[model samples]
Target: MDEVVNAIADPVRREILALLRERPRTVSDIASRFTISRPAISRHLRVLRESGLVHDELVGRQRLYTLDTAPLTGLAEWITFLRSPAGWQHRLDALETEVRRTSRERSTTPDSTAPKENTA
Candidate 1:
């Protein structure tokens, strides 16, 4: 999941993914639309492949790349969970994650204690 997130972090890589999303394209087909060198685009494609967001197949002499959206399912669900505002429980969970991250960074244990049960 981190890999997928990191892969999409770059605008150039995001554009490559968008191109592949439409249809499978060869490296040249993808590189033609960008100002970067073909080698640079190939490097971006390698990152996408490692992240499981893209798949490459050898068709004759051409290597075709296609988008694989399966890896994005978990990411999409997490985004949806974070975006929901109707559930206090959902918001609390998100807050807990942020708090724990902060606590870990500061090496403090403010949240080490268990959360009190809500009986209201």
Candidate 2:
């Protein structure tokens, strides 16, 4: 999971993953989307391949890279755990309290900034 996390930490690598998600692409196809050099894109692809986030298959003279999301299962679970209802419930309760407090203060505070009524 750490490798998967680290692999996707780079914005370029994430974009590569998005491209793979849409469809398999060759190194040239992936490299075309970024301003970075082909070697840099190759390095990113290496990291992704090592992390099992992508799979490459040689089709005749070209290699096509495809996304393999199985490795992200653990990361997904960790995220779901982090965003559990228990944690969000407390946060929502606190937000509700703060909102009510702010509303009460606004209602009670002086309306000095209020626009004066037009006297025809």
- Give, for candidate 2, the lowest lDDT window spanning 10 residues: 81-90
| Per-residue accuracy of model 1 over 1-120 as CA lDDT, tens digit each | 899999999999999989988999999999999999999999999999999999999999999999999999999999997777766877898999999998788686455677988999
Encode model 2's per-residue lDDT on 24-77: one tens digit a residue. 999999999999999999999999999999999999999999999999999999
Instruction: Kindly give the number of clashing pairs for every candidate.
Output: 0, 0
lDDT agreement of model 1 with the native? 0.93
lDDT value for model 2: 0.96
Name the runs in model 1 displaced over 4 angstroms. Answer: 86-120
Cα displacement (Å) at residue 97, model 1: 29
For residue 19, what is the lDDT in candidate 1? 91
Residue pairs whose backbone atoms clash in candidate 2: none
Relative to the unseen true structure, what is the C-alpha lDDT of residue 82 in candidate 1, on a scale of 0 to 100?
78
Error of 2 at 20 (Å): 0.7
